[model samples]
Target: MRIAIVGGGISGLVAAYRLRTRLGADADIVVLDRAERLGGILYTGDVGGEPLDLGAEAFVGRRPEVPALLGELGLTDQLVTPAGRRPLVWAGGAAHPLPPRTLMGIPSDAETMRGLVDDDTLDRIAAEPDRALTWYPDGDQDVYSLVADRFGAQVAERSVDPLLGGVYAGSSRSIGVRAALPGLAAALDAGAPSLTHAVAAALPPPSDAPVFGGIRDGYRVLLDALADAAAARFVTATPATRLARASRGWVLDPLGLVDAVVLATPAPVTARLLRYVAPKAADAAAGIELSSSVVVALSLPQDTALPDNSGILVATGESLRAKAFTLSSRKWPHLAERETALVRASFGKFGDEAALSWSDADLIAAATEDLATVTGAVIDPVEAIVQRWPGGLAQYAVGHVDRIAEIESATAELDGIELAGAYLHGVGVPACVASGETAARRIAESLSAPAKS
Candidate 1:
């Protein structure tokens, strides 16, 4: 049996790795990627002689998949938690501490969010418990609509937008609630009277375990380990442009016939690749929106005083062009050991493409300027590295859940074909890994089934 996995991102890599472990020695596996390098968005760059992640840096440790995978790769010891987990929000020309006991910016206790929201908004939030319960919408809805409806526009803009933007790199007003914040959606559907109370009820009891985990060096370490484990024929700089049905199974153009195929590319690319064979799935995949972003990593002088918080989430309507900033040195103790300070400034979102048009030098200048403004300290950077990810994040818009279901149902009719990636389910590293592994298992089962007799 031969299996061809398209795209060498975490999803593809994980899928290939799973196939290798589950299949027999007779099975042949190959991973095809368009880019020259593997790991896709999990890029780690060097700055001031220390490794820093340019793309996705951490995974939620609460998920068992990543930690289990790490153990399998002998990377359990390399897991490191953030030194400071609290992130501040830069709004109203100042950095305000993020309210505690909130789930993705949805405050559990209105009283705890005193300074975060204005007096009018605070009053509105405080009155939420007494407000009449509205029936949950039957269909999918955007996060901002649900949040703003319950908490008012101010809380939606100041709290929810920054947190959701930090995750999706898209507007909460546009991203779907069911796809992006499923727990909150479930709570709402259960007839929860208040958003705050619903979110509070959904959250698990506070524990000592760290919310997120990262590798000692970088996420690249995990990618390298996956590549090593898979030990498959890697075809870099060669993307599977077309996928079609063959006499026996599936055919990935230029890669020839394979018993199974795992499409691990982004939604847009996947749509194009699957168009000829599965038009319904392709069309549904094409409907999914994406957002672009740029991460500018700056190496500052050793003496540069940075915020003690993990990072600052730039609330919507802030004067700063950068959406957020991570005090890399402060957040990761491994980087703090280096002689210089490392900061990563994020720019661009769904509708914000102005920063993408700027040159590297211009982007650095703008990021640095925003850094100074938010940090309230004038500091010059010694070195800078800019990384642009066009269509970096998949925006789960309204009806995304239904669209994914339709795509899955369509793909189910096609033999020996499966889809997996960040676009399908959650966008985190763990979710991607789970999706890929699940796809691989499904393909393996289909391939091994007894002639369907």
Candidate 2:
């Protein structure tokens, strides 16, 4: 079978890799990417003679998918957990440690958040049990609204926004609960008495395993491993412009006929390709909004006394332009072994594009200023790299799950085609990997099944 996997991001690459494994030597598989390189946003750059991840740095350790994949690829020894786990939040002109035992910024114990919130807000949160139970209506609701309605606007702004923004580069008011925090959503849907109670009930017991893990060298190693294992034909700087139903299977523009195609591209790109064959699916894909963001990585002098904390998340309404700052050196000890202190500052969120509009110099300056305020240490970055990801994050808005369902239904009518990416399911590396593997297996099954004779 001739198969073409589009996008060449982690999802596409993983899909291609899995397809090769499932179909073995008989499969004619080609991976196509618009860029000259694969790995998409999983980019690593050299800073001060050390490799640093400019894009995603780590994956959640709780998800077995990535770890299992690493084992299979002989990369089990490369996994390294963070040296420090506690991350602070910059709010009220100061940095405060994030409260413990919280489910995605929702504190399990109100008293633990005393330093983060005022007494009045704490009192309101303490009274969560007394508040009237209001079940979410059918369909979807924004995370901010749900949290704010249950636990005051201050909690939503200070806690929920920062955590969600850090993950999706999206606002809590815009991201859907069902899509973004499925566990919390499920607990709520089950009619849990209160937000606190629901979160506590939904959260698993704390474990000794680190929440996140990264590669010892860099994510680049993982990408390189996948590429070597897949051994598929790679077509760089070429994107699947169009998809047409051919007499045999499908024809990808300029790529000729393929028995199957997997779209691992971003939503907008996928939507355009599917417009002709599956218009409804394309429309649904188009509805998925994206957010642009910028990451400024700075290599400070070795003498810089960075905080022991892994990073600092800037709460909404904080007097800082940078959304969050990661003490890369401290978080990843491997980087700390180098003679320089590495830090990464994130700017821009779903609705905020002002930072992205700034020049690289301006953005770096702004990030430096914010970092100084949060860390209380003067920073003189000897080397700096600014990466601008336009439409880097997909905003899973209300009714997103339903819309995805509809998209899948429409696309299912068309044979030998599948959609897979961070846009579908969660945006984490594990989620994307699972999505890719699932797509590959589905395609394999479809091809192996007896045709409608």
Candidate 3:
């Protein structure tokens, strides 16, 4: 049997790798990528120049799936973590050391972060323990609303938004926190308990958390490792424009034929490709709103005194242009020399993609303004590399889960079609890996069912 996987992102690669590993030489698999690259958004630029991840910086230790995947991929020795002190949360006016016990600024106990705010502010928070979010999982609540309710408006607007903004390149109030941090939602559902207790229970044990980790050469190490293992036919720079069903199984127009297909591309692209063949899948794909973003990697002169040894996160309010700033060199010292700093400035989201069209000069100017606000830095970066990702990221809203359920139901009627990408589940690297593997399993099951019949 022949299996074809579409889109070359990490998800697709994982699907390909897992399928190969599982089926052995039984299945003839081929991965089709329109780009010459294999890692999709996982691209690691300046590989030899100075190792740093332009895409996913570190894998969250909280995710057991990540560690499991690492071992499965034989990347056990490549795990790398921050080399410095605990990370600092930049909020209000200064960088505050992360309190003893906090979950994304929502302290399990109000007293834990007492040093962060005055006693008066803490009093206001204590009066409201329910933190009952007017918003719920029903596409009605947003990141800011949920956090502000469970924590307080001050924490949400001042601190939480920026951290979330850094992740989604979006406004926290509008973002679907239930989608991004479902554990928080689960915590909220726990009755009478503080959001803190709920959070602790919903997530794996805290001790199991990895500070943060990636390959020494960056994420590319995994991508390179996967590519080396793929003995299947590889097709690059070729888009499977149309997927027409053939009696044998399926025919991918101009891109050759296949028995099964794994789509790991963006929603819009996937929607357009499947519109004619799988209208419901296409419609489900179309419902997903897209977001654009740009990451600016500025190489600073060594003399620059960064905010701290640990990286910095700009409260959404703190940065008008640059949503977040990370002192990459500080976060991963090996990425720079004694005299150089690999500082990353990020910009993007629904209303703020204008930064994408700006001339290189304008972008640098705007980013510089953010640099000044977040850090007291006055020196100009000696070199800058700007990367713009147009319509790449997926946005999940309330009712998103339900909508996906409907889409899945509609697509299930088909025998051999499979969908995989960030659109369905969590949008992180490890999560995407899980999605792709799930898709492959679905396809494998569907292909076998006919024989049983």
User: Can you tell me which runs of candidate 1 are displaced by over 4 Å?
Assistant: none
lDDT of 3: 0.72
Could you give candidate 3's per-residue lDDT for residues 131-234 as a string of tens digits? 44343324446666655665667667555665666656666665675677777776665552555556566655547344566677778888877766766778
- For every model shown, what is its TM-score relative to the native structure? 0.97, 0.98, 0.88
Tens digits of lDDT, candidate 2, 1-453: 899999888898899899989999889999999999999888888888778888889998899988898899999998888996589988888888988887788877688788998988898888987887787647678988888887778788888888988889988898988888788888888888888888898788978988998988788888899988888999999877889999989999879999999999999999999999999999999999998889999999988878898999999997789999999888887888988899999998988878888998998899888888888899889988999888888888988999899889999978789999999998889999998999999999989989976
Q: Considering lDDT, where higher is better, how would the candidates rank from best to worst?
A: 2, 1, 3
Report the Cα lDDT for candidate 2.
Answer: 0.88
Give the per-residue lDDT digits (tens) of candidate 1, residues 1-453. 899999899999999999999996668999999999998888998887678899988888899888899899999998888996588998888889988887778777677678888888888888888888675557778878877887788777888889888788987887888888788778888878777778987888889988888888888888999999998999999978789888888889889888899999999999998899999999999999898999999999978878788899999998889999988888888878888888999998898867887899999999899999988877799999999988888998988998999999888978888899999998899999999999999999898888864
lDDT of each: 0.88, 0.88, 0.72
| Candidate 1: clashing pairs of residues | none
Q: How does model 1 score by TM-score?
A: 0.97
Q: How many residue pairs clash in each candidate?
A: 0, 0, 5
At residue 19, candidate 3 shows an lDDT of 79
